[model samples]
Target: MVLIFLFSGIQAYAVDPEVPDSEEAISAGQSIFNANCKTCHRLDQKLIGPALRGVTDRRELAWIKQFITNSQVLVQGGDADAVALFKEFNNTVMPAHDFLSDGDLTNLLSYIEFGDKVDPAAAAAAAGAEGGEAASSGGGIPNEYLTIILVVLVIVLVLVLVVLGLIVSVLTKYMNKNDDLDEDDKAFINQKTDYKGIFKSDGMIIIVTAIVLAFVVKTAINGLYTVGVQQGYAPSQPIAYSHELHAGQYEIPCQYCHTGVEIGKSANIPSANICMNCHMHIQNVEGKDGISPEIAKIYDAVDNNKPIEWVRVHNLPDLAYFNHSQHVVVGGVECQTCHGPVEEMEVVSQYSALTMGWCIDCHRNTEIDTQGNEYYDKLVQLHSESSNDALKVKDIGGLECAKCHY
Candidate 1:
């Protein structure tokens, strides 16, 4: 009888009464997750944060609430679990979400519990409705209004100019008829006032030709210089790898797959082994009927002991030299600074021109981060002592020809 009672209690606890397993709650939770948590947390995979599918099951509800509300406070107070988590994640601090209401938190918890059970079609429909609602709520002046205003202004300016020309013509005629000017003098004045004839004169033509020739020469030179520059050159890769899904949605660090980024010359292409780390278990995508063909390619390569040939997107000239570690690690430059919004890209493409002028502009404008860098400490101190201006990349031989070229 005692054993039977204990089993009943276990069953009751499994189905909690406080957390409502409703579609509305799940949808609300999903929205919250996408907006806030999706950047660092994945449902079934470890990203910057731990997999949060069964987080509630692992920890008590009260403890979870406290940790989520203010993890730093808990860590500072010497809470064993919080400290352990902080240490485990290489001391990466979780941002506190104290602003989330109790109702919102409950909904988030409910979604975590029953999110896997929710039908994909239904979820998509709900998401579409929410997106439409958001679009409707976004209030701004339409492009049509601005275009109409510009057209009207141009028309008004043309009308004003025509009226001014007519006024000038009448004044000239009236002055010639009423004033004590001779017929020869009047004829000479009319000849001078012939705007069309003046425009068609040899002097005017020569000046215009010179200006045109200068513009054409400049344009041709610019075109020649940009012959090999492949800005926005997005080539189709062997696999349809979505950087948006991996980096943007899942918030995987750029350095995670590009292992050599912080230590080597090249930001090496991710090998099949790196893909296998996650794809070993997540064989199929969520909405797909079978294993994703793109993911399968990786598996096939690994099994057959072959390398996946990923096409290079961003390429520099053979003469130029670039080190990934120098910029990424030492200089503390963000990957997106050169690559653009890589997380938003469905198919990764060259976003920047990557021209000599572009690199020079970056070096001229970018300020070096001197804090915690022992190499730059002395240089920064000398500069600070010498002048009030902050030290930029150009100040430390960034623009030198040898810095980029061998």
Candidate 2:
């Protein structure tokens, strides 16, 4: 019966694309999860947080939103469910999520509801519904809007310029005609012809002002856009490595490849010795006998009988600094969080935008892991004073420039 209702709900939403239960809410909820919840919570399994499966059945939407928006508060308020869950999890408060708006919270609730009652046919139909729309579009500023705006702006600018030029020409001719007058008269005429003064008084003044304003805005936007992009950076390697296979299918733990992340300053590229540990035994792969061609690259660098060439990914610029220890060890950020799902990738790619905006967004929204990290003991103390017990990432200073830049 529950499954039947779920299927009916999906079909009902589908027949009415403008309806609330349609994919928009589901996709928005998915985005919210990807951005905020996936790190600690899984839908079906016990991770850092309780499995979210069947959450809708167990909790009301209002309670779920409040819990997600501020779990610590519910725990402190002695809400039996929140308090019991908190204690069950060792009194570790789930991080507060004050950033999600009411609409976003609703979307998440809808998704949770859908997940609980999902039917396979409905799921398939939902997936197939948007295929045509996605494939036909390119990802960038939409050309249609860009073209329309640019054309309108150009036309307005040209009209303004033409009017200004006409006025200037008239003034210039009048001034020249008065050239034969007395010197004082000529000086008066020249003053009347002053193009700069005319520009200040005419409609041209507004046009020039608008142009300057537009230029300033464009420059400021571009400056902000480049703040955290590392387009072509390549760094020296501890060992030569090939991403082709490891990422391709051997599907080694990203933590395995970048092991140092669990304990040190970087998701440090594995040292040559680490490579030897694996290469020494599983020297061959993909049915190619002997040290696979890629593994041989590692052996070459180690100066062992065989060698390997490892290239660095996620290289921070010289001006910027990164600490794997701080993020991985202290913040409890997963290695794959910033580096991306490297195990499933063919070649490593810079997955996170690593932009200041991107970093700050995560920092602002992510709940800090406060339970065991002594660094957050003081913050946890203050939060306890409030009836609400949520601990925000900001409360722990995740957005401080020194946290990343220094």
Candidate 3:
């Protein structure tokens, strides 16, 4: 009993007499504290102000609310209790927040009462919104998947057609002899069996002629479609060059080897001097038992031991006038964009068809990075007014025949 009394005495001394015990009062205090008090005071740590971790344990909620509402007022009233606290906190005066509404104050207090607990409902709602956005942002379906589905559909259709054909053949063979058949039935029978030299018969001949005509028309259409097409053209080069090597392992910059990219029309093949730049140091290489065959070719080309013959890899037709700098430097296209991931290639072959259609398709999709270039300011303004964010090469006169031909 004596120890209990001692403990109670200490607790009584800690709490202010003015404070009240009420949930509403504590809630009201909390809202105001979060909005204003949170800027300086944390529940446990001394940020700019003293920690309020166990303030409720130390003082009555009512007293705390009174101090919160107006600490200066309590001090002015000669409240030794308030004065002592102000002195204890190094006379650091807590500011009054007159702007906070009663409801706002209540919410702030509720947060303090609950402390830190994850709200599952809020988390779930956020996750749902994120998932919905991700679903919306994705393209409808990948082409490969769509193609696979289409192929399966086609295969199913073909199987159905073949089965139907077989069924018709069997039915015709069985029913033709069994019928005192009608004219159409007899004709179908004749078509099916071709018995008694049906190929010599007029109707059968007409049907065959019609089929031959239809085949001819389809073939003509297909031939027209392929007039200027070169789908699988693999041209021979003078050099046994492997786009795979220089582009693949070494990651030699395309422009470094193709030095004429920025300054002139072609991404010209490196001269013997450029080859010597690296080859001089790399001669008698380590990889394949020294004396690298490829590097040796460069040495021979320089005529240190007679001029080496280098076959040309890419040769634009004389009729077409193309400028590498216009596309590479001005347009800002990487070599690999056209050449296709050459760094991974051992022997570089033309990845793109490089046809007019291919070029136009690329032009249609590519966007220009015109954010800060003063040269594009006028063009950008025009585009902004036109409501087109994408700037294709064609929009910048890239597709004009004169641009390529002249």
Model 2, residue 365: what's the lDDT? 80
Candidate 3 per-residue lDDT over residues 1-406, each given as its tens digit: 9568545533543443334324665566566665467655666555445566556666666566677777898888888889997886657577775565555544454445434333457778777655444333223554445567889999999999999989988887788778578998687676635467776899999999998999899889867754433333233333455666666666677778878899988777667787778766765436643344455456445544344444343555676776788778888888878777767754455566766677778777888877778998898788778875677677888678887675
> How does each model score on lDDT?
0.80, 0.66, 0.64
Q: For residue 224, what is the lDDT in candidate 1? A: 76
* Every candidate's CA RMSD: 22.1, 25.8, 27.8
Q: For candidate 3, give the lDDT.
A: 0.64
Model 3: CA > 4 A from native: 1-241, 285-290, 304-308
Give all TM-scores, in the order shown: 0.44, 0.38, 0.40
Q: Can you write out model 2's per-residue Cα lDDT over 1-406, one digit (the tens) per residue?
A: 9768767765553232222456788788878886777655656556556778557667766788899999988888889998888876666556788999998887775665454455569777666544422332333444455666799999999999999989987986787786467887766655644677676786887889899999999989867755543533333333334465665556666676577776777666556677778765776665754334455455444543333334444655666667777788778887677766656554456777766677789877888788877867887888778737478776667777776785
How are the candidates ranked when ordered by TM-score, highest leading? 1, 3, 2
Indicate the TM-score of model 2.
0.38
Shift in Å, residue 113, candidate 3: 99
Model 1 Cα displacement at 280 (Å)? 1.9
Model 1 per-residue lDDT tens digits across residues 1-406: 9568545533533655666778899889889877767656667656556878767777888787788788899999999988999997768677889999988888888777666553457788787655444333122543444567789999999999999989988988887787788888777767655689889999999999999999899889867755654777776677889999999999998889988999989988889999889987785678754356577677657755789877677888899988999999888888988999999999998988888999999899899998888988899989899878889999899999999999
- Provide backbone clash counts, one per model: 0, 22, 20
